[model samples]
Target: MTGPALRPVSGVPQRWITVLGSGPLPGRPELVADADLVLGGRRNLDAAGVPADRALVLGPLAPALDAVAALAPASAPAPAPAPAPAPSDGASATTARVLVLASGDPGFFGIVRALAERFGPDALDVRPGTSSVAEAFARIGLPWDDAVVVSAHGRDPRTAFNACRSQRKTAVLTAPGAGPAEIGAALLAVPGIERRLVVATDLGTATERVEELTPAQAAARDWPGVQVVLCLAVADGAGGADGAVGPMRALAGPTEGPDGWALSEEAFEHRDSMVTKAEVRALALARLGPRLGTLVWDVGAGSGSVAIECARLGAAVVAVERTEDGVRRIRANARAHGVDVGVVHGSAPGALDGLPAPDAVFIGGGGADLPAVVTACAERALRTVVVTLAALDRVPDVRAALLAAGFTAEGVQLQAARLAPLPGGVSRLAAINPVFVLWGTRTAPGSIPVDSSATTAPSGDS
Candidate 1:
């Protein structure tokens, strides 16, 4: 301590690079003084008053990233001097100091991702600012906790559009082509969904503007540059102080469910008993795993019992039925249960073509084309494929189709008996028809068979 005045070892001098967020320039004097090369947008550098020789203008991301990588190594040379300014006294002029400037919380879906990909996380120190999404929501005085945030920046807008379709609250980060106008136009195309759009542009900057518009209004006007869009359900939103719509829908669709699942046949009004039995439906529903933000296909939906149950469990349902009476029954049962089910009046393997790909599929009636229907469902399904059969001869073929489609196929036969009242007031078992249920899940290639025994024919129907 007596030999030299002890001082705290500063981490800034050791850090070769800094990726700074652009807001009002931060007062990191030590870091700025040491920076030999400053890479940023021309506007950002100009706003910070950095000299042209020391500041490299960012153009395309890939090339700029390459330039940064070239200067990243410890042995790399320092940037050229700005005109004829003499080096600062008693400072390390030999060390290379690189600075990258990005907008608003560089870590939040910003330039940090690219830099991290090239240099790794430990290589750079990031000074974060407020994200555009956070700033956008603050401008309207709305909480963003329940809102689904999606980025359409350099990505297909389909996923963002889908989130808006299925969710009541959503915020989309806009890119060059995928901005407010494109999102608004897409929302208008959705049938029953009506969303009020709130567009916030260049937040935290002097020229910042926030506008509330209808889907049509946003689509009609030209919106350029960096922006954020909030899609709110008009029916559910409460009016905000800025005259913008507030989130009213309590986290998307219906929150309640029937007291229990695999409900009795009487719960739904059906012709005869064309519905899948309660016990069978319980097993099928377990395999399907129907939940929110997922779509399930009910191929050959019959009385729509399975479809209605799926919709009740919070999955979007599409019931495909060929006969007019069957389609009517499906709609009526859906209405009776107070759930939305898209009724497609057509046959399967054909009707499934236009419908969105499903997370799971339930095949209740495939007639003679059961194998073909199973094949089609297996190919399209993302998670599980379940099929019910009454014919003993078709079990092998159905199992084979599932296996061929790269699935871990399993089968179970359910036979149930209800307590019947005898004349003498004694209870007796009344046997219900035994039905074979076959289900398949997508398995990784080269994986061992999980249910090889399931493919074998059952011993007997008890």
Candidate 2:
């Protein structure tokens, strides 16, 4: 399936093949060659439009696509599972002229990729419908082009929540457990974010409805038939777009990872207690490998140096600290650096719950029970853990906990000396105390990957 590229733009409509929901059929679906239409689910969509009897009723999808979970049309029998292609199901005359009926835009986290991943050139077609996501945004009357959209179907909900919480605007395609209710609750528990939750339930249906509430209010409400959610951050205006005046540019697009991290001391913001030393920050980031579509935590984010830097590298960070004053300092630092950080005002462990699950976590403070907190992060299977320690005594305990959790451990002791002018013209090197940085990447067995898709097809939300 991998080739020069899946050039949907260049392909002619007549030659392009795609499956779609009953609503908003593509121009090519009718404009192309005779297509075999399998009207499988609801019949509310008119059968009158099809060339008489040309439409085949494959029956209702009960167990077929679980989203089509309720009773199917009264007229049809139980639907059979649409068998995915076997190795024998190759691109030959036997598999010619294909089209499958999907409840929504199959490409919007549906069956289209099953086709795309398995099929080759001129072997696919697509006509997208207004997904549950598009419908959600439409109900709110908000322009969606500027929103960061994510899907929570068969995937962890944290990445989706983090995207919505950290960005000024976002739309999430929800699954049963990861729907509006769960997303709202997660955001509510976050320390530094304020959001207005909107859930568009049963969109484009008989009972279609929209509801708005505070994150807390939304969390406590009942949700049903909710297909999409827009959990927009309350105030980082003009909506994070291309060319926004921020250091977030490096993370805005796709890029490969860098090798050999532990950068020099000059790369960050510091005012004595202002930031994590750059050498340690680099080690932490390398272990974390924070990038687009990943969530990270910088517990006790003092100057927000690590958290802001992670945001710049394309991760959504939630910086948790105990003091209101510390929160202020982090926010100010975040603004100056041109990145987004959901700053929380609370101490560790106690404040950690309700926050979205992180792909990696960096703990710059907290305390002796810090090992216990790290243990909790491991329990959630956080992909990476990086802790900076000033006290040598705690290193052994931290190392033991990481090992117990099955993570390979590593540490670096970094010390930097700056040139300072003495009373006269002569300069003397002044050394800072060496600090030990402990870092661990979650092993394969511990963490799960996001349902990520990268397209060479130019940048469009769709």
Off by over 4 Å in 2: 1-18, 21-98, 103-108, 130-141, 205-207, 236-274, 335-340, 343-346, 349-356, 365-377, 417-430, 447-462
Specify the highest-lDDT model's number.
1
Instruction: Give every collision pair in model 2.
Output: 17-124, 17-125, 17-126, 18-125, 18-126, 383-442
- Residue 191 of model 2, lDDT score: 63
Write down the lDDT that model 2 would get. 0.62
CA lDDT scores, all candidates in order: 0.72, 0.62
Residue-level lDDT of model 2, residues 278-383, one tens digit each, is: 6667777777787767888888787777888787776788888887777887888777765668887888778887776787888886377878977776666467
Give all candidate RMSDs, comma-separated: 12.1, 9.7
lDDT of 1: 0.72
lDDT of 1 at 48: 70
